[model samples]
Target: MDSVNSLLEGFGTAMSPLNLLWAAVGVLLGTAIGVLPGIGPAMAVALLLPVTYGLDPTGAFIMFAGIYYGGMFGGSTTSILLNTPGESAAVVAAIEGNPMARSGRGSQALAAAAIGHFTGGVVGTIALVALAPAVAALAVDIGAPDYFVIMLLAFIAVTSVLGSSRVRGFASLLIGLTIGLVGLDQMTGQQRLTFGSLQLSDGIDVVIVAVGLFAIGEALWVAAHLRRSSQKAIPVGRPWLGRGELRRSWKPWLRGPAIGFPFGAIPAGGAEIPTFLSYVTEKRLSKHPDEFGKGAIEGVAGPESAASASAAGTVGTMLTLGLPTTATAAVMLAAFQQYGIQPGPLLFERETELVWGLIASLFIGMVLLLVLNLPLAPVWAKLLRIPRPYLYAGILFFAAVGAYAIGGEAIDLVVLLVIGLIGLVMRRYGLPVLPAVIGVILGPSAELQLRRALQLSDGSLTGLVNTPFSITVYALIALILCWPLVRKLPLPARWRQRAGTSAR
Candidate 1:
């Protein structure tokens, strides 16, 4: 009841004219940027971070919430119309959505995607409203040791789960931690990695790192692999569902959120897994399984809903635990830091209006997305027709501007280019970028918690595992790290015999 009352108050705050306008602008910008090839929500938020520097924290976050959801919607648009997924989460959509487009059911695919996105986003947000407060209540009791262990788990999870090679992912994380280590030590007042430069003492701004890695790096990469030819996007009419199409979609829409939210709320469980799972689940249950590869409404609906729900789940985790499960959430976490606001257990108590308002804005954003996008999806599709060279040039320009705006220093540009190069190299080597960004953002905080835990225990290493929570989390981390080796172990004779019997 308290949560409900707080949410109603939040709706009041979010529905104010100014905040509503910001939400609208954010949705429009997010969709526009998301429709472009290779630009996902993370880059969109990073590139647009500079725009929010002037706004108050509440308004900025409201806009970010809109942008986050809008990006998911726009990615589906491209996946359906062009068979080009704007981000990895949308890849499943293209498998069936593009086929639907080719087969003259483009409007139906778009409608299913839009409605599914709405359904998943709303359900997930409601779950966040219910779960975040409870989680935050529990999180308030977490000691520094437990927090440190959790961060460690996050580090391991991202590296182990994201990419094909754990080695490359850890390598990327190391690079980010190295960048994070540049600042003066808070406890000892010592300059660890400043390299004798006063500018380095304050450390590299996360904004520069995020923008350089996502925006500038992406531009340079696209420039290198620039294709002279372009494919035309399939024409989509206004997105609307017939009664039959709606009936086919309703169940998948509900099921998608159930699969997505849990995966998204946990550490290292990204949208890719849940969206893929939703796709596979829908395929198995769908009545028209034969139409799957060719153009099944269930395929489009399930994955799209899962993607949106996963995004909301990511946000809930970010708000409650100060942990980010996805790239876009990481960038938004940085945005929170930029406002001198840390997201965690105390945040709801300290920033009640801000928290609730942000939550309410998500609901509002969903409605606006459906109302505007259902009619304007055709216009959004035309965005793909824009030439790549021009789009990338604009990205480069904004990247430089956003980087310089961080501190208004010429040296920032140099740092930006250097990081951009590193980003390009990482991409070339197929290193996943999420772990690196997570490392950069979480490294300092983890360091703080570790020192605090140690200080309290007088430097006894056992202090790290003194608590039940810490012990359990560390055990989980060990299981994650050793699971690959566990898999390589030979099966017991009985199990092997059973497996052979099953095969026979």
Candidate 2:
């Protein structure tokens, strides 16, 4: 009942005229940017981080919520029309959505995706409202050692689960930790990696790191692999659904959130797995399985809904546990830190209005997303026709401007370029970017907890595993690290084949 009351109050805050306007602006910008190839929600948020610098925290966060959901819908537009997924989560959409377009069912595909996104997002947000306070309540009992181990688990999970090569992922994480170590030591007040430079003592701003890696780095990479010819998008009309089409899509839309939300809440549980699982499940359950691979509406509906739901799940975990499950969540975590706010068990107590208001705005964003996407999809499709050089040039310009605005220091630009180059290198080598961003954001907190735990135990290593929670988390981490080796052990031929197939 208290949760219901708080949520109702949150609606009041979100419905204010100024906050509502920010939500509208975010939806517009997120969709516009998300329609372009290679731009995902994380990159969209990073590029536009500067725009919210002057706004109050509540308004900024409300806008971010809008951008986040709008990006999901816009990415589907590109996938359906151009067969180009803006991000990995949208890949499944291209598989069936593009074919639907080619078959003159593009409008139906768009309608199903838009409505499915609305369904998943709404369900997931409702789940978040119910789950986050409970999770945060449970988290209040955790000790420093337990907190440290949980972060350790996050580090291992991202490195091991994201990329094809654990080596590359860990390598990226190391780079991020190194960057994170650039500031003055919190305990001893000694600079570890500043090299006697005054500016370095303050640490690299996460804004610069985010914009550099996602925006500048991506722009440079696209420029390097510039394709001279642009692919034309398949023409689409206003998205609408018929009665029969809605019946076919409603089940998948419901099932998609069921699959996606839990994964989103878990460490290293990204939209990729849930979306794929939703696709496979829909294929097995569809009465018109024959229509699959040839442009089935269920294919467009299921995965897109899963992707949106997973995004909401990611936000829940971040708010309740201070753990980021995806790149976009990591950047949003940085946004929280930028406002001098920390997310954890204490967040609800300290910033009740902000947390509840943000949740309420998500509901608003969903409705706004459906309304905008249903009518303006054809307009978004036109973004694909933009010339590559012009689009990239604009990205680079914003990257520089956002970076420079951080402290108005000329040196920041140099740091931004250097970080951007490193980002370029990471992308070229198949290194996943999520682990690095996580390392940078969580590295300091992890270190602080480690030192506190050590101090409490008189410097004994056993202090780290003294608690039941810490022990369990360490055991889980051990299992994750050793699974690859366990998989290689001698086993029945059939079991080995099954393992191999699951691994792929």
Candidate 3:
């Protein structure tokens, strides 16, 4: 009941006229930028962070919610019309959505995607509302050892599970940790990696890192590949779905959320998996399975809904645990840090209104996206025709501006360029960037927790596994690290029984 009252109060705050306008502006800009190829929600948020420096925290976050939801919807528009996914999360949607466009059913595909996003987002927000407080409550009892273990699990999951090569991922994480080591040590007030430079004492800002890696690096890479790509926008009519079509979509909408939220809640960096799973499930259960490759509506509906729901779940996880599982969530965490706010169990107890209001804005953003995206998809599709040189050049411009805006230090610009070059190399080598981002953000916290645990145990290593939770988390991390070898092992003969009726 207390949660209910707090939520209502949140609705009251979010419904204010100023906040609503911010939401509208965010969704509009997000959709416009998101429609362009190679731009996802994380890059969009990183590019916009500089402009939000002057706004109050509540308003800034409310607008972020709108942008987040709008980006998800806008990705669908591009995927269906141009056969180009804005990010990995939208890859499954392009498998069928583009085919539907070629078959002249683009309108139905757009309608299913829009409505499915609405359903999953709404349901996921409700789950967050009901579950976040409980999770925060439970988190209050965790000790330093448990926190360290959890961070280890996050490191293992991200580095080992995300990209094609664990070696590249671990190498990227080490680079981030090295960057993180440049600042003054929190305990001894001693410099570790700073080479006697005054600017190095304050540590490299996350905003600079994000903008350099995501915006500048992506722009450079896209420019290299730009000339070889040709894309045409498909026309979308009124996105009208008949009652029969709506009936076919409703169940997948519900199921997609169910499949997506848990994956997002866990700090495993598996955001792309749920969409693929949802797509496969929909195809197998769909009555018209043959229609899948030819542009089935369920194919569009299920995966898109799963992607949105997964995003919502990520919001809840970040709010409750201060753990960011995706790149976008990592940027949001950096935004929280910019305001001198630390997100964790204490956050709910201290900043009740701010947290709840952000949650409420998510609900509002979903409704607004449904209204805007369904009709305006064709309009958004026009963004794909933007010339590659202009689009990428603008990205570079913003990246420089964003890096320069942080503390007005000329050294920051140099660091940005250096990191941008590294980012390009990583992208060329297919190294996943999320683990490195997470490592930089969490390394300091992990070190703090480790020291506390050691102090409590008089430097005894056994203290690290003093609790069952810590042990379980460590076990999970070990399993994640060793799973590749396990997969290579052949099954025993007794366990390899064929699936067939008994001959008796």
Candidate 4:
């Protein structure tokens, strides 16, 4: 009954004409930006942060939610049509989606992708509505120490699961923490890391880092690998899948969300694992198993749906836990902090309307993007064919503009350029940049929380292990952090021999 009333209240807020209109505009803009390569939802929101300065918070938030859903919708398009995934979540979709396109049923592949996106997106929204309340209800008892513990758990899990090399991941995280510490000390009337530069005194802007690392870095990477090879424009057949195709795709759609939502709710490593799992499941369950790799529709459908579902699942964690498993989620969390809206267990109680409205808008936005994309995907693909030089140069220009706008200092632009170069170098050497970004975002907060936790427990390591739940949580963190090392234990000759012998 209480859930019903909360939902009713949510509908009242979501149904407002002003909110509805903003939601529509946000979906459109998100789709438009998502269609462009290297300009995903994180980049879109970060770039638009300055513009939200004058708008009402509710309206701006609704728009931000639309952009989030819209980017997921738009990401599948590039993966299937151009074989260029706009987001990491879209990477799995590109595996089979691109192959299906090359199989001369590009239209069928695209329709499957669109329908799958819609199906999974709707399911994701439902899951959000169903789960967020329960989570929030339980969170009502949580205090500052609980939040601190939760944040510590999140930081450990995120860094541990991000890269193959834990050392590298921690290194990246420390770099981010260092950057995050650049601003003036909050408790003191002094500065910590500002080397007397005026812009440094204000600390580096999150928007600058987001845009430069994601948008600018990607542009530079593409420019370095720009190919002049002619891509024979593949004809897109009828965009609508037949009833038979839809029937076959339904299971994958359902199964995908089941796989995806949980993944998004976990650490960054969690999402990638499921894509491989989904592919394996689809391959085994496919009625037309022979058609896999030869354009089996399930191959394209399952991963596409799962990836989007995973993307949606991150929202619950971000909103209720104030933790982000993915780089994009981290950026969104930063955006929320920028607006002075700290999302966590207390968020729903304090800002129920905003939370529910945002969830409701996702449902609306998914439908809107489906309608907009179904008949007009070909138009969206034109964004991919833009000359690389032009696209990259424009990105550099925007990075400069966004940097200057945020800090109004010439030094911010210089720092942005330097970071972009650092990003380029990191990408070149295969160092994951997301950890550094996450570290920068969470490092100081994590430190403060740790200090508080120590203080609360009277500095006894044993005192910190008071609760069974938290004790288990720490054990879990240790296992995850040491997983790479644990898996390398040397007593498994049978396992190693079996794998090597099987390969022979």
Candidate 5:
């Protein structure tokens, strides 16, 4: 009941004409990027952060949320229209969306993504309202020791699941921590990694680092592989689903959220796991098994819905405990700090209006996104018709502006270039960039906690496992980190009983 009152106050602020306008603009920009290929919500938001520096905090956040959801919508558009998925999660949608497009059911594919996003948004927000507070309540029980343990678990969770490999993820996190530790130590006045550089004493800003990694790096990659090609997007024929289409889609829509929400709630969870799981679930359980891979509408409907819903689930874990489940979420968390806002534990109490307003605005944003995206999708797809040189040039320009805007310092630009080169090399080797970003952001925080935990135990290793809960969590982390290796090992004879691909 108290929560409801607070949320109503949030609505009061969110619906104000000024804030409302920001929300609309965010939706517009988000949709624009969503339609463009090789650009996504994460990069778009990072690029646009500089432009928002002078804006009011409330309006800035409203716009940022729009860009986030907008990117999700846009990625699906590229996947459906060109079989080139602009979003990682959209890969699942492409499996079915591309097939639908090939069969002249392009309109149906778009409709499914739109409807799925709307439903997923609503479901995720409701879950946010219900679950975020519960997590915070649990967090209140924590002592410094518990915090140290939780942070360790969070780091392990992110490294094990967020990246392709645990070692690389840890290395990325160490780099971030190293960067984070450069300035003055809060407890002691000592400078650990500054090497006597004056600028290093102030510490590197997360926003600057985020811009370099996601936007700068992505722009560089685009420039290197830019290609121009196009067929104008097929216009939506029916625009709205027919009775049969809805009947076929109902189960997938329902089932998708169930699968997606759980995956997104896990530590360092991303949309890929749930969408793939949902796709497989649908194919294996669908009554229309023969229809799959042959324009089964369910294929397009299930994964798209799951991907969006799971994205929402990431909000709960991220907001309450400072855990970032994906690259985009990590950037958004950085955005919160840029505004002097902290998202974990005390967030609901410290800035109730901002938190709940962001929640309610998601509902508003979802409606606007659906209306705006459905009609304008074809125009958005025509972005493929854009010249490659101009497109990448614009990307580079925005990347530069975004990098400079936050720091107003030139050396930051130099760092941006170096990181961009690193990003290009990582991309070439199929190494995931997200874990690196996570590692960088969480590394120092984890380090401080590790030191604290060791001090609590008087540097005794056995003291680390004093708590059964802490021991259990560490074991879980060990198992998860070992998952890839486990998959490659031979299966026991008793377990090799059945064989069939899960239709998804």
Candidate 6:
């Protein structure tokens, strides 16, 4: 009842004329950023951080919320229309969406993605409203051991469950871990892999790594494979889903949020794992399983919905626990700090109005994104018609610029180039890029939690599994790691003999 009243009060605030206009502007800018390669919600928000300096906190946050959802909607547009994913989460969407675009079903693919996002976003927001306070209250009981275990689960899931080969996924994760080690150790105050450079003290920025791997690396590889004849884009009509397609999508759309929200709520959560998991689930359940790698609409629907729901869950975690799970959420955390707002259980008590307003704005943003994206999807598809040379050139330009913009340092550009080269090599060798990105992002945090746990236990390793929750999490990780080997085991001779006897 209290939640209901607060939400109603929030709607009153969010519906004001001034806030609505800000929401519209944010949605527009976020969509543009999403359509462009290399620019994600984090970069868009980071770039616009200065513009919000003078605005009131409520208004600024409302706009930021819009950008978050808008970027998600726009990412699907690029994935479907151009076979380019503006964010890592959208990579799953591109697997089927791009093929659909080539088959002249681009409009259908776009519609599925938009509707999926809307379904997931709306559901996720409701979960946030109901679960955030309780989760925040429980978070106080979570110690470093719990956090370390959760991080381990995330790491294992990404590396083991994502690509075709576990070897390649592990290799990618190792590379990301190595990159993550390139700074001063948080505990010892000693440099581990800096190689005596001043700029290396702070560690490589996540924004630069993301842009280099996804944007610049992709551009260079495409450029290398450029052919003499220009490729033509398939023409797309107005976006609409047939009754059959709609029937196929509804279940996955519902299921995606269920899988995505919990992952996003966790401290180590990121959208990549949830989206991939959703894709695998949809593939397993789909009647047309053979169409998965070709142009299955379920692939696009499930993953896009998961991505949006994960984003919403991330928002709730950020507000309730002050946890920043994804790169974009990290940027928003910084925004909160800029305004001297510390998010946590106390934040709700202290800043009730602002918190509810932000939550309400998220609901508002989802609707605006659906309205904006469904109508403009065809216009977005036209982006595919741009010449290859120009498109690749633009991607590289934005990648470099986004990297440099992370900090005003020239060395950032050098790092971008090196990582871009690595990305190209990974692409050439058929290695999945997402595991590496996840490794780099989560490795440092995991290390911190482990160290904190050890410190608390006076260097006793037993403390790592002190609680029932921590023990369960570790057991889950062990099961995930051993499942593949378990499947490979041969039946015992006695069991085989019994089966043969029964057959005889």
Task: Return the TM-score for each candidate structure.
Answer: 0.95, 0.95, 0.94, 0.90, 0.90, 0.73
Inter-residue clash pairs, candidate 2: none
Pairs of colliding residues, candidate 3:
none
Off by over 4 Å in 2: 488-504
lDDT (Cα, tens digit) per residue for candidate 6, span 352-424: 8888888888888888888978887777656555666776777777666666665677888889889989999
Worst 10 residues of 4 by lDDT: 495-504
Better of 3 and 6 by TM-score: 3
lDDT per residue, candidate 2, 1-504, as tens digits?
778888999999999999999999988888887798867789888877886678899998888878888888888888788787766677778878888999999999999999999999999999999998999998878889988998999999999866678899999999888898999988899898989999999999999999888888888888889877767889989888889989999999999999989988887646877787788899999999999879999988998899889989989999988898989888888999888898888888899999999999999999999998898889888888888878889889988999988999999999999999999998888887888888899999999999999999999999999998899999999998998887842222332242233222
Per-residue C-alpha lDDT of model 3 across residues 382-470, encoded as one tens digit per residue:
78888877888888888888888888878888999888887888899988878878888888888989999999999999989999989
Give the C-alpha miss distance for residue 243 in model 4, angstroms: 2.7
lDDT of 5: 0.74
Candidate 1 local lDDT, 1-504, one digit each (tens)? 888999999999999999999899888887887788868889989987887678898899898889889998998898889887787777788888988999999999999999999999999999999999999998888889988998898899999866678899999999999999998987887997988999999999999999999988899988999878888888878888899999999999999999888888887556777887898899899999998789999998998899889888999999998999889999999999999898988898999999999999999999999998899999999999888888999999989889888878899999999999999999999988888999999999999999999999999999899999899989999998998787842322332342233222
Compared with the true structure, model 4 gives a TM-score of 0.90
Worst ten-residue run, lDDT, model 5? 494-503
- Candidate 6 residue runs with Cα over 4 Å from true position: 5-26, 29-68, 71-113, 227-231, 240-307, 310-358, 488-504
Clashes of 3: 0
Which regions of candidate 4 fall more than 4 Å away from where they truly are? 230-233, 269-271, 486-504
lDDT of each: 0.88, 0.87, 0.82, 0.74, 0.74, 0.78
457 Cα displacement, candidate 4 (Å): 3.0
Best by lDDT: 1
- Model 3 ranges with Cα > 4 A deviation: 488-504
Q: lDDT tens digits, residues 177-237, model 4?
A: 7888887876564787777876678878777777777767777887888777835445566
Residue lDDT tens for model 5, 381-491: 777677766777788788888777877888878877877777777676656676667666666666676666788889987656767666777788778767777784232
